[model samples]
Target: MTRIRLLTVAWLVLFPLAGLADYLEVRRETAVYKEPSKKSEKLVTVDPAERSPYLLKLASGAKTKGYYQVNLPGANEKGWIYQSYVRRYKGQHPGYVAYKRTFYKHWIDEDGDCQDTRQEVLIRDADAKVAYQDEDHCKVEASAWKDPYTGKTFTNPKDLDVDHVVPLKNAHESGAWTWSAERKKQYANYLQYEKHLLAVSASENRKKADKGPDRYMPPNAAYHCEYVRIWTKIKRDWELEMTEAEGEKVQQILENCN
Candidate 1:
């Protein structure tokens, strides 16, 4: 009877239709995330930019290499609530905001959500058919706001190319070459909907091409730290490789982030 039962288990292990049954051995030993446990392996450190609490503060307790074990707050209940909702919100900002009489609110609602805000910005731009600021600070570009690199301002998006502080080609050379098309697209379009995509002068952005943030970003005292944070977030999310200089610059920026 024992031998017959062992054979049955072996069959399930090798059968494709058995699906994850082959993983039973691991499943039996490892804990599942959904199952609550008083004992949780702690994660030593999580990237602050992507982590919750927007406090961006490190936990005062012990550190481990396991899951964070904390539930993040919902979009509407957190810091910069309107900022978060900008991703999908629809409809237009009042005409005055569009015309620059009032600054374009980064997120439509003040709740910190981003989804609806993205939809709203895009749709409104489509409806108005007016040109936004250009890289040269000339009228005619849309989506061009601040140029952190030069600490200059631009309104025309047409004269700008949303820069990759770390170039996409560099990403491909690193490990992104192994990623699926969907993930590649996500990494490629990293700044498509965020404030990261700045409208800078054509000559300046071209000069930056695939150069690391340290080499190309602006020297303006005020914007330098934020630039590093943005660059680090992109590379960390995409799991891209960094040169020594790039890493060093990121460290410097992190200091200011605190």
Candidate 2:
């Protein structure tokens, strides 16, 4: 009877503490900062090669501007650092690699239409000022080529939407859930440059809503080459995962890109 009572008491005490630990981990893990320094004034910035109290790596870089940066929330005990340093640090540390381009680049804009499409949608969406709601003027869509899931092509901007090759949910499920809001936004707005986004059929876009890259690719066997490249780039750049089938498909496509 006494042992039973003691176990019950221990459970009560430990349960809340366990819950508290979980809450703290989730809170700390998910919160992303606008700029790394803004969130924690005491946070330190370091070189990728320098041995520090934290485990950090160079995640990405911006060569156009001379700023370097590194990734935080790393696996080791040196502790967390700022996000702004991801790129510069990466350049300094040759071993610290990051993503450079996507397979979408290969999908040539024969008409050089990506920039124009993006600008038009941006302007229209900005003018309306709401996203994903009925009031919004722009939509998220796939490419103009006929979607294999459903044969349709969209020429009209109003009829198309931008689709993330790797779904945002998949990204969130991957380590992205731990990223700052700014990083999430950056990832969401990725490929703002050129044919990275497409003006595709709206119904097809809906069918692919937040689904992973493998879920809805062009069915035409010929298009798979470009399709796999885009998928691989997105997953690798964002550090997302793939089901075995998806990974194999990507491998097959990458052979072609190489």
- Give the candidate number with the greatest lDDT: 2
Tens digits of per-residue lDDT for model 2, 52-106:
1112233333322332233223211112323333322211222222332341222
Give the count of colliding residue pairs in each prediction.
39, 17
| TM-score of every candidate | 0.44, 0.42
For TM-score, the strongest prediction is 1
Tell me how far the alpha carbon of residue 134 in candidate 1 is from the true structure, in angstroms, after superposition: 18
Write down the RMSD of candidate 1 (Cα, Å): 19.2
Model 1 residue runs over 4 Å out of place are 1-144, 191-193, 256-258
lDDT of 1 at 5: 8
Q: Give me the displacement of residue 104 in model 2, in angstroms.
A: 21
Query: The CA-based lDDT of model 1 is what?
Result: 0.38
Relative to the true structure, how large is the alpha-carbon lDDT of every model? 0.38, 0.39
